[model samples]
Target: MVNNKQKDAPHAQWPEAAQTLIALMHAQGEVARLSEREQLISSLLVSVNAVLWAFNWETRQVLYVSPAYERIFGRSAGLLLADYNQWRDSIYPDDLEYAEQSLAEVLRKGAVEDREYRIIAADGQVRWLSDKCFINRQDEPGQPVIIVGIAEDITDKKHMETELQRLATTDVLTQSSNRRHFFECAHREFAEARRHGSPLAFLLLDIDDFKLINDSYGHPEGDNVLQRIAECGRGSLRRGDLFGRIGGEEFAAVFPGCAPDMAVQVAERLQQEIQRLRFNHDGQAFSITVSQGLTNLTEADESLDSLFARADAAMYEAKRQGKNRIIAA
Candidate 1:
C-alpha cells in the first residue's frame, strides 16, 4: 500500500482550492456585466439630441455634462466641467438674468419646467433652449444640494412660430398689415389717443377707376397697380404711421401724433406720387389715380367708428365731385 498521510493531505486542500476558483469566476462575471451596462448608458447619452447636466449648487461646480453639449453649444465639455462660468458665458446676454433667476427658482419650487431662453454658441450662432431643472435633494437637508437639468435645442421651433405669426398678420400680395391686424392695432392706438387727448388722423383711400383698369388690362395688371400703390404708401408714411390693405383696391392709414395740416401735406404728397407712376400693359401706357378721405380726432367724436363713418362719407364725396383728390372731413 501507498503512504496514506500524503494522499489525505492532497484530498483535504482540493475543496478549498475549488471554492476559491468558483468565487473568482463569479467576480469576473459581475465585472463584465457592469462594464456592459456602463457602455450602454454612454451610447444612449451620445445619441440623445439634448444636453443632460448635473451641478453642485453649493460648490457651484459642473459635475457632469452629456455628449450633446458639444454639438448644441459648439463648445468643449471638458472646459465646462473645469469652470462653471463657461455655461454663464454661453448664455445670451439679454437672457442671462432671466435664465439665472429661473434656475434659482428650482430650489424653492422643486422644479422649473418651462424655462426657454437663448444662448450664444461658440460659433456665434444664437440658439434657443428649453431647459427644465430640478433640485435632487430638496427634502434632505444634510445632503449635497444637486441640480439636474435637461436642455433641448428649440431654435427650429422658435423660427417656425415666428413665420406663422408673420403669415397671420401680413397680406400675401402687398406684404402690408392685413385688415384684422390693422384694426387690432388701431383700436389700441385709439384708446391711447383718447386717454392722452393726442392728435390722431384716419385716412381711407381707394384706387380711382379700378374696375375699368381690371376690365381693360386684366386682373394681373390690376394686381400690379395695387402692389405699386401699397409700396408708395409704405414709403410715404411716417415711422409711427400704420398702413394696411383693408379691401380690394382700398387701403387705410392711421397717423398718430400728426397735426391736421401735416396730415394734409402727407396726403397731397402721396397723391402726387401716385399720379406720376406709369405702367405699360400690351405695349400701351397708362397712369392711375387715387381718391382719399381724411379725418382728425375731435372733442365731439365718440368712438373710432364715428371717425370711420366720417372718413367713408368724405371719401365717397371725393369720388362724386372728382376722381383724383383728397377731401378732409
Candidate 2:
C-alpha cells in the first residue's frame, strides 16, 4: 500500500539497527557465559580436597580461605578467618622458621614459592602439607601485593618416603642400622667429636665360635641368636649410643661422650648380658658369649677408617687370646 520511496527508506535504516541489536545480544550472552564459568570454578575450588588461600601483604591478613581448610586442619573455617594467627600457630614449631623464610623470599623477590612442612591438627594428628604460591603485584605503585596459593595434604607420601628411607638404611635381619648407615653416622660423629674435643669411643663386637653354633644348631638357630644379641645390645646401650650390624655375627657401636675407661665398662656389661641370654630350641637350652674391642677418639685419628682399623685389630687379638674377653686399642 505504500509508495516505493517510503518503503525503501525504512528498509535501508532497518538493516543497520537490526545488526546493532544482534551484536548487543551476543555480547550479553558472552558475559553471562563467563560469569557462569567463574561461579563453577569458584565452587570447585571450595569443594576440592586441597585448600585455596589468598593473603594480603598490606593488611598482613588472610583474605580468603576455601572450605577445605576445615577438612585439612580439623578446625572451623570461621576460627581461621577470624584470627590469622590461628593458622600460623598451628604450624609445627620445628618448621615455623622455614615457613617464615619462604614467605619472606616470595614477597621480597616475587619468587615462586614451594614449601613442605608439618602441622599439628586439632585432633592431635601430625599432618604434612605441600604449599605452592605465586605473587600478584598491584598496578598501583604503593598498593599491597597479593599472594595466592594451594596447600595439599602430603602426609601419606611423606610417611611412605620415610619408611622407604628407613628400609634402605637399616639391616633387615637385625633391625639395626646397616653397615653403610653406620659408617655414615660414624663419620658425622667423628667430625663432631674432633671439632668439639669431645670424648668418643667405638666398639667392635663379634660372637665367639659363631660358625660352630651354625654348624651344630642349624642356620635358623644362628639367625635367632644374632637377633637376640642385637636386641640385648640395643637394650644395654645408652640412649645416645649408635649400634649397627656391620657383618655376619659382627656389630659396631659408637659412644659419643664416653671415655675409653667408661667404654670398657659398657663393653663388659654388654658381655655379661650376652652370657645371661638363654635360648631354648626344641628341648635344648644354650647360651652365647661375645668378644669386644674398644677404642677411644684420639688426636692421631684422621678418619673413621683409621679408627675402625685399630678396633678391628684389637677384636682379632681378643679372638686369639681367650675368645671371650674385652681388649682395648
Enumerate residue pairs that collide in model 2: none
Name the weakest run of 10 consecutive residues (lDDT summed) in model 1: 135-144
Q: What's the lDDT for residue 250 in model 2?
A: 98
Q: Per-residue alpha-carbon lDDT of model 2 for 20-133, expressed as tens digits?
A: 999999999999999999999988987799998988866778888998888899988887777888888999999999987887778777765469999999999999999888
Model 2 gets an lDDT of 0.90
lDDT of 1 by residue, 149-210 (tens): 99999999999999999999989999999999998888888888989999999999999999
lDDT, candidate 1, residue 79?
A: 98
The whole-model lDDT of each prediction reads 0.94, 0.90
lDDT of 2 at 155: 98
**Clash statistics: count for each candidate:** 0, 0
Task: State residue 80's C-alpha deviation in candidate 2, in Å.
Answer: 2.5
Could you tell me the TM-score of candidate 1? Answer: 0.88
List CA RMSD, all candidates. Answer: 2.8, 2.6
